[model samples]
Target: MIAETRIALKNAGKYKPEDISTYIDLGGYKNAEKALKSKPEDIINWIDEAKLRGRGGAGFSTGQKKRFTNEAICDKCLQKYVICNADEGEPGTFKDRIIMEMDPHLLIEGMLIAAYAIGATKAYIYIRGEYTQSISKLHIALKQAKEKGFLGKNIFNTGFFLDIEIKLGAGSYLCGEELTLLESLEGKRGYPRIKPPFPAEKGLFGMPTLINNVETFAHIPYIIEHGVEHYRSIGTENTPGTKIFTISGDVKKAGYYETSLGVTLRELIYDLAGGIKQDKKFKAAILGGAAGTFVDHTVLDTPMGYDLLKERGAVLGSGAIMVLADDRSIFEMTYSILDFFKHESCGKCVPCRVGTTQLLLLMNQAKHTKSDRIELLNKLLAEAEYMDQTSLCPLGQSPILPLKSIKQYFESQF
Candidate 1:
């Protein structure tokens, strides 16, 4: 079995939905309250000292993001907004859903920490529409938070008043991008805007907004209570803290598992996920999500995180690790992933919008001729190369990378 560590999911699968006291008792809000009392620069210092990186796809430094948010909020004279991106659209990624549904108060506490740290007056939890149970749980916990004065005006007798709203996303995958998410929240079409004026500068109706993944915010209380050193002790020195991964596909014990930053994919699968079911042969593993690259069984021993995976031409994209056993067909899986991209492509860029359909058409015709399959493979590579270089945002940019990586690294069925 894998010797995994837990942090963001600390209370997950171990707490009642409405148990605010359990959260408080388990060291929640201590960080936010401390941050509320401490100097803002000190808070930024603590974050940078801990070396906490974003758990989102980009894996940016959380400290730097917070510093930027603090600066933006101060300059704009805009009441900051804290948003929890619980719209886990990547297939094989279920950590966010597990977090929100299992320990709703943890999500709430995470939001509160952000509000305190950034001087945010309001917060929003953007959830996927498919998370019915998670939404119900959060709603109850939210009411409890408001009634207990943890969320309403002047929290904990401090001048920080934070009202957290739970917003339901219609599950448009394009909205997973921060800017696109803001547009969707405003009841507009969920399409990404060009960057330069990032969300930290202009977000949520031109306010300085700090958006974080559920797990990233969840680490704040722990960091405050334990100090930066304590948080750094568990994971790699630079990439400190544990990451929650959602392992799926034909594994023996597929589920969510939390491990330190340097944990290997082999340790996660063969040990934590109970290896291939019935000890079936391994074909390949998709690190991150469908947007991530593929790795063969030999490379499964590689570590799972931001830096190491990049060395392998992949990324730890949202901690969604999917295992493909020998019995599964790569053609079918690749096609399904491409189709999902097509449906969620937002039509904002021509490369992703038209390119996906063209790839699909070629794949459909590949059933008859070998040359057709090879031609489709070449086109897939070309499209991915172009998309990565020219697309407006990551939505179109990443749709084809996984397929191209799979084709290059793994033996796909023609």
Candidate 2:
């Protein structure tokens, strides 16, 4: 009987998705108005004090990112940019789309606060193209926001100006990565840029850019509206605030549920999601999305937080919990996941481009060649390890997570 602690999703299912006034009546933009009057440095300090981690998988410090972008040195006249990563490409992860379609204005207000905090007048919502409903709802929400002075010049007469535009992603999973997403935003092929010059220093159009995902941005207003103490009162000491967990697969009531960060997987699966479908025995759960690790029933009561999961060699990536029944085939699921990585590889670097294909081929060979299954599994692990060490981006490095975790928990199947 673990209850949901809804913060970002507070307005969901409670108002008209396309109506701006309803969102306003719910006291949506009041925080943004209050934020506009405050000094940008003070706002950044407030976010720092709140200890809001990025909700879009990375769990980085939101305040640190803003501070970096704000303090970054460029041509004094160069404009900074705020971009929202709404690609939502991770398999079984639909929480961002829900935020966009259900409460688009919340995202807008969050972006507004971010842009103001970082001294940016322009913002973009780079959303997945296939999300037709999300795109349409955001379009209407942007228009409504512009009409209401929530956007554009001199918002709340504070001499601050901000405008947000929507950019459609052409269905590339690689673009969900922040650096790769930046390349796509610039109309280049979706390939990841090298590090050391991270996005905070040199991002979109070679300016200081503040890039945060939809869920991360959506949490800003809440943190601002409720003081840092109130915000910290929820969730764990290190990972404060609620997380939106999207549960799918064999669960009886599979969908998105928002709760505090420390909720156990057992609570999420057996209690909230109604357990495995048809009373079947539980086998394993993919705690994150496709790129996430697989876990057996032993870790069910482990709290779902970034640090807690990381300590167990797992990630709370994308907060996507995909359950599996004992009757399901782990090998088949592993193969399908490998095949997906193979298709999504951008071919930017040799490791991912060839490694993904080789992994898939090796899996196919192992499936048919029963005697060498262990040998092939070893080879797969080695190849994934190589790719993890050498790949240019996360897509190439990600196969190791699922491959290793699956092998660890279900080697007998292979």
Candidate 3:
């Protein structure tokens, strides 16, 4: 059975918008109810106690970000913003989409908890342009939340005022980055920024802002209501809470499945995904997403989490695993993944912009001429290795992870 997410995503898809009173009846706003009664420091303490880490691709700790943003808010700024990043643009990661569609209310409750802890009265959930259904669902839920006592002035009669707005994107994958996301929110073209002035310090139009993934927000309500100890029992010591996996390709049951962290990749594909169809032999798996690590059968038993994947030379990422079996051409996979990075580079940096285009050209040439294949492999893998670590942003870097790992594991197939 799938283990339920208690802290962040408890009320998603289970309740309607007009049912805020019913949600309150069913213990929906209990966390906020309690937070309103307790000190702001206590709310921060609770999240730290829960060990609630960010489920966005970055996996930064929410408690840590909150602690930083709360501290960074200037004495002059009157408007602090808590932002929910709903732009789920990773190629194979659709788990965030599922939670946004199913449980927007839980997200709102989480927002309330965040606003209370950080002294923010305004929040926005920026969704992708492609997610028409999820955007509509968020709009409906936000409107209902305003009508109920859960949102607006004096929430639950506590004199705390919070309002949430929904914003739509033009569908750029780079906007998934926190800085680029803030840029887009301000009606500018999305371009990632340099660190040392990370979003926690100066974000969302030069004000203190906190941006978290949809899955990260969905987890908040459960953590606040159930407390941290119960939530910590589900996953690893450092990586607590159930994770939503979006597994695709060469699998029978390709969809969203929420399971505890540290669950084996074998269990995900073989048990949860029902294994390969028509008895096809297993070849490899793409742990994370298109821009993530490649795991051959040799590493299939590795547990899923943050530190574990890092040990296996991967980052676990947003938990979007793509299974690949025999008969698929490694050359084709390499070309396709490179092509995607080439198109999505945003041209903000030369290494990624020029490098991806060159890789694509070399891939095209390699496809036709067998002699150029080895040369292309060396050039692409070597350059990609350099780019992954040295690029201006994670986008430029991760585009080559799949290509390099594929070349390393399945050299014969290419």
Candidate 4:
């Protein structure tokens, strides 16, 4: 058995993405029509019952987010927005790009359902600039959807209107942050806004907004078509439905694989991804992306789910599993991750701005004594913890995850 589920990626690599006829034949827009006729609260309730969480790094409740936007006190602004976060810039993560490239219509259908549920008339897809093929495919798909009346005014004669626009990002990793994405979509520099006025209250031109990743949106139509009970039956009780994992680095099959949330890491590597490359022993795996924690080989049997991994100080962040072979240097890998964060820090907060620079400088110093290196490492970890508490947005706080996890699991390499 493959021991994998194909919910979000069901249409991927199985049909021509540019053709609407191909998508329609596979029951593409059927759930979208269902959503138009159903009450928004009914859809939200079903999602809540199914326990569908965000496929984004946060793992927040998707139904709760929609409910918040629906019930938000938006007296100041009458309009609401729905955003598709297609900016798959996280290192070792490319699942969203595949969906946009190979199954663009699925994303469109999911977005329509979400918009209808949240009562949002306007939506935006903030895609990465590097995704030329995905963008092109989404463009064609959007045009087809509009022409077929799956989008635009009076969709399916239900008097519901939703217009989705595409905004290409300039490859700023910080733009993947929901607030920063809103700023970028509004033609401002990509900098994260402070919390207290969360996106559910004020977002996207000072209006309520519901933001979710491409994969999170893609599951909506499936959950709506298939009952919530059916969706819940696939995965564990807490994290129901399937997840799309992007395995890279030393894996033999370095690509996307969709499976239930609670599958063992051993099965994912050996059974699904053809095991480590060159028959080498697995030294470690970075669950999630650069902002994710590192796991040693001993934890290969650990279940891959949100709550299960959280107990081990790990995350299924965006479903990225970067396999590291024994030959790979832990120091070099840590340095590379730190470098990405150093370059991508938005500089809006002092803790993140200074912490990333200080960490990089300490790691770059080659002439330090052994004791000095250890002392510097301790200070860098302190700084990372401080950043986690004080940083304005997730970009500033992300450095702590890798730094702390690497220090815990691979400190001897330092």
Backbone collisions counted per model: 0, 0, 11, 0
C-alpha TM-scores of all predictions: 0.95, 0.98, 0.94, 0.97
lDDT of model 1, residue 377:
76
- Cα RMSD to the true fold for all candidates: 1.8, 1.0, 2.0, 1.4
Query: Model 3 RMSD to the real structure?
Result: 2.0
- lDDT to native, each model: 0.81, 0.91, 0.80, 0.89
Per-residue lDDT tens digits of candidate 2, residues 291-366?
9999888889889889998877788999999899999988888889999999999997999999999999988877
Alpha-carbon error at 144 in model 4, in Å? 0.6
TM-score of 4: 0.97
lDDT of 2 at 253: 98
**lDDT tens digits, residue span 1-414, model 1:** 568788888777565777777777766666667777777678778888999898877899988887788788345464778888888888888888888888888778767876777778888888889889989889999998788787888887877788889899996888888989998887898988888688787888888888898888878778877888799898887688999988998799999999998898889988999999889998888887878877777678777778887877777888998898888877787878777777778887887787767667767777566665656777777877787788888877886668767766764453
The 10 consecutive residues of candidate 1 with the worst lDDT sum are 405-414
How would you order the candidates by TM-score, starting with the best? 2, 4, 1, 3
> Top model by TM-score, which number?
2
Model 4 misplaced stretches (Cα beyond 4 Å) = 366-373
RMSD of candidate 4 to true structure, Å:
1.4
lDDT of 3 by residue, 1-414 (tens): 333343344555566644566566667777778887778887888787778888887788889888888888577786788999988888899977787777777788888889889888989898899998888877877887788778899987778999998888897988888888898899988888877687777888788888888888777777776778888888999899888888899999888778888888888888889899777988878777767877788777888889888777776888898888886677787778888888888888888888888889888877777665666778888888778777788778886677667676776666
